[model samples]
Target: MLLAPLALVAACGGGDKGTQEPPSTTAVLVDTLFTFPSQWSSPQLTLKAGGTVVFMFEGGIAHNAIFRLNPGNPPLAGAPADIPPTVNAVVRRTFATVGTFPVNCTIHPGMVSEVVVVP
Candidate 1:
């Protein structure tokens, strides 16, 4: 009797777990001067207007991400604060405004990437 009840419960709990949504993606950044030739894990990333992106700084290296204020990219209303020079830091930013955001590392020259937000 117990085996039959257990079998019924297991059958009732059967559903395709593959239909679930995948885990959120994140970007990893490291100091190019010491780690890799390029600092960015990806040159560019696109996200929805309300989506969030996580930036992971590799350990044992001083790295910071600053949103550059240039001609096209003045300032974003919902941009994350500039990441300070840290050995290992994790920053999350929500893209509320739809625009192209340019990120750079002040410690390393030629280290740059862009994040595009769409509607």
Candidate 2:
């Protein structure tokens, strides 16, 4: 009887030894040259603390996406420095802070997007 219980415990533990949790996934697609459709587009992105944002380029005419500080904030002066642009490429960034950030395309000046990171 003792062996039966030990065998049951061993069987339960052995079944989970090689099992792994699934990886987290997030995909945001940019469509067209400078226009992002609602299906895969986001006006504002909300990311969990330490969460990642995956920007996927769908059908587009070689556009770039860049992150920058909001110029409207009064605390800082001078134009905000542009983060390196991701042109026709999938970009992933992990946000560690909770704040609002402005993003735009360097190639297409009018194409803009926003990212909102939350704790």
lDDT of 2 at 117: 54
Measured on C-alpha atoms, candidate 1 has an lDDT of 0.65
Residues 6-117, model 1: lDDT tens digits = 9988886656887754333432222222223338776777776776667777756777777765433655666766667766666776666777877777687777787776
- Candidate 1's C-alpha runs over 4 A off are 1-38, 70-78
The number of the candidate with the highest lDDT is: 1
Residues 1-119, model 2: lDDT tens digits:
79999998878654454564333333222222233532336566655555566667556545545566433444222213343534456666555566665666656656677666554
TM-score for candidate 2, please give it: 0.50
lDDT of model 2 at position 17: 46
lDDT of each: 0.65, 0.52
